[model samples]
Target: MSSVCSTFISSSALSIKPKCANPSRSRSKLRINCTVGDVFVFSESVIEQKAVSTAEPLLVSAVRGENVERPPVWLMRQAGRYMKSYQIICEKYPSFRERSENVDLVVEISLQPWKVFKPDGVILFSDILTPLSGMNIPFDIVKGKGPVIFNPIKEAADVDKVREFVPKEYVPYVGEALTILRQEVKNEAAVLGFVGAPFTLASYVVEGGSSKHFSKIKRLAFSKPKVLHALLQKFTDSMAKYIQYQADNGAQAVQIFDSWATELSPVDFDEFSLPYLKQIVDTVKQSHPELPLILYASGSGGLLERLPSTGVDVVSLDWTVDMADGRRRLGPSVAVQGNVDPGVLFGSKDFITNRIMDTVRKAGSGKHILNLGHGIVVGTPEENVAHFFEVAKGIRY
Candidate 1:
């Protein structure tokens, strides 16, 4: 009998390979056939796995603090709504949940930008809230309104109804898609996985969707502190397991997104957000010491000093903070990613090029991954994005 693995069937990423002076820069088409007891390992098959992983991606090398010629470049939301290719797929699939939940669609959508521009990282084409359904929080991504939670969790009893996620069980398509991504990208770029931080996930569930004031969740946090902590603890536990599961399934690195964490005052962040983020980091590190964990909190200018304490390998900086200052505050131990205003992509190609230079110069080389401060905004010109990547990948020293 032939041994089987779960690589997604629709494998596509620029069949035409580009030539590079440093052959190491080109992504090899990996065949994941690492065998153990008639089973195959996804990321373990390549020589890169055997001897310091020969095909170790630039992104991986930079994250690990290795010497490198240039900062690895990829954008948050590099895939999805901004790409014409992705929007075309959305037309056919018609459901955000289905597009993300199905392995084939996930692989195809994730590769859309990769095939076109080949960024230094390929993030899984799934949402931060993707794990919610698995955790028994029913939700949907609306066309215009954004994420909706059918039943908001409040009180101790509602929190009791939540389930810890088992990614292999609930979103096996995710693992399957990731395995397919690793095979397809061939370690040319780091394959990234992401999950919502405890506070962020709790905000969506408690507030029922996107909120400007974040008043509902803040009310819960400020008034009913214990009840909120109980809910947050469940998410901390669930997301840590989710990160480990992603790594096992072939995610080269994972990012934790706390999109709403800045809503808390420093005192509140310490009380509510910091400890849980720390717990997730501690738990995952114990299990996969070599795996890299990245943490991003929007509007984190106030909290940059406190971020590195979570023990994450990388602390992603939003545009609100200057790259040099963010770098100085986070210090030399942890790697830093982003600080470019995503809005910069909308400027002239020359303008975009100049900004990249400024960011790279400030980051001071190595221990850096060049990226947009946040997800590429919708309606950004495709040609400019291509130009951004062209200029980014061409840098030396």
Candidate 2:
């Protein structure tokens, strides 16, 4: 394995500069103090660079089933809320509301995770509600409510009233952020973009926010199947276009966040949720065949059997399920990501290390992507995060 030794440099020490070679393969110089034995091994596939920036593609070939010595790692919601640097940057702005709303701030926060973690990828910093906000849905992030909608979609007309798809300008913020992240990240890591799945987005819009029972959405799905499908279809069309937009600009991969997909019974999921998800995935694939697509469904232990039918390149499991069990059920074709309970991060370093090792062992020898089963809970000790990666780096397939 190739290695480099150097003194650690602060993330800010790296500067993004204009590229003279192919934009996708260009490298920038970064200087760090280091010793003779300090080693860094990059995938032979990555173009060597003197300095790292967002311009280099994140190491996605591993996720696509390519073998490499070091396993790639990145966290869900790696950007914002979790990092002190992100918090400090946000403080410079007036409010969390103002900071998240601004595209430039969003890009800056998104890059913060990359700077700190040096993860294999950078997920875009925007929330799932961004597209809805662009659609003029009148939504806001209430402290406990998650997302509160001023006007919920109760009927077909309400769905019709909202534009069926995102207009380019309304959400140009995402594209702008991607462009900056692409240039800033360079080949050091891959940049990921995401959208809420149709059913999940519909759940927030239909239920008017977060829900424990999802009674309203369930009732609508069963009682007014046509209306639900219509809404789902519209959202599917919009999400497909949204994901494609990200891929077009520079995202190496995209994820569909079906955070609420676990709430449905398998039968209901097949009827109400899977169809629209298939629609979006299929449509997006038509346009960007090579882009990796990850479909993450939280609390989806019961529906693991049905996931393979969805056509997602990767399936992200929640913490409750055993990784080995999920691998067996989902079979060998799909790459498996995550299943470590975020709560585990709050425990002792030994506990976290043991758990991560167990997960790596259970994942067996096939395509596997390392990630938290869910997001990193805010206020987690940063040392725990570091230990998780440290242990993960030591594991062998």
Candidate 3:
């Protein structure tokens, strides 16, 4: 997620039946396309459970479903626009790419939240689309317009131009910054690296930028399925390598952000989003088996059970889903993170404290990571955020 993102699916919209299909399919032959969203009624499927590796960092340990006295606490966009320190840095360096691509600036901004809040996870101050240029998808983050792709991909020819990302070649700064963050934090917290899930990145490239209604991507999905599938496949391979690149460099854990996954109905999500996500998880697991992989899809109340089928280590919940219900759906096999409304920080400290306690109690004990349901909204009080960390860290089982 960027500093700001939008959700397309309304909670009241047609709900996906909890009955799920096999969401995990390898890359060799993924012909998951169906009649848009009318496909999956979800029948029971076997879910493979990976043994949780023991790790030092609290976030890693907690994600592994380890026995921890307190669940790790970190916000989705902890190192972001809301922080005054980041605002000061943004003023100095006006360019989003410059701030994110420059090793020194990225390191400084990523550590800003860590220094002030001492979060359990220190996510890299980078965007999900940071690797686009390396993949031959030229883009820029505009002030009010958000991301703008110079040439939006639509045809078979356009998809061919999008190259497989060589992370060390295109985004060395990211790897270097992650390495430095690991050294600085010294295992006190997990250093997170993230990539946009295929469907989400494809949205930016296909639609030219963020859309209030994702009509273009939907059109491609409905009308020209092959074209969209080709694009998604390219991203699937590129991102798998990107995750491995980040893990090899120094990232303790990596999060996959499918910000636009909710835009598609559950049936459509299986075809367009799930297979590629499972492929990425599968690829990363081959090498970095112990490294924790987390997936976030905003407003994913209906898709909770379907997420674990993708084989991710942890499934991050949005505020729309209750923490307890989310925990129960994901089961003990998958670790759970988030469900606290980011808007809660705007409330009084007592309200904030009460919500945290309620979420914690409902989440029960092990395998829980405390975080905002979504990114911390712009203009959140720094004091309340500090209090969030204070109260969350103070809790004990």
Q: What are the per-model numbers of colliding residue pairs?
A: 2, 23, 2
Lowest-sum lDDT 10-residue window in model 1: 1-10
Model 3 misplaced stretches (Cα beyond 4 Å): 1-55
Candidate 1 TM-score to native: 0.86
RMSD of each: 11.2, 8.9, 14.6
The Cα local distance difference test for each model comes to 0.82, 0.74, 0.82
Global CA lDDT of candidate 3, please? 0.82
lDDT of prediction 1: 0.82
**Better TM-score candidate (2, 3):** 3
Taking the tens digit of each residue's C-alpha lDDT, what string does model 1 give over 165-251? Answer: 888889899999999999988777889999999999999999999889999898888899999999999999999999999999899
* lDDT of candidate 2 at residue 253, scale 0 to 100: 90
lDDT of candidate 2 over 1-397, digit per residue (tens): 1111110111121221211212132244332222111122122212222355443342476667776544567788778766788768856774555666688888878877666556777888878888886676888886545678899988888877778566477788788888888888777778899999999999999999988899999888888888888888888888999999998877999999998988988888998789888888889889888888898998888999888798999899888999989999998888888878899999876567556656666776547778899999999887677656544543334
Q: Clashes in model 1: which pairs?
A: 48-53, 48-54
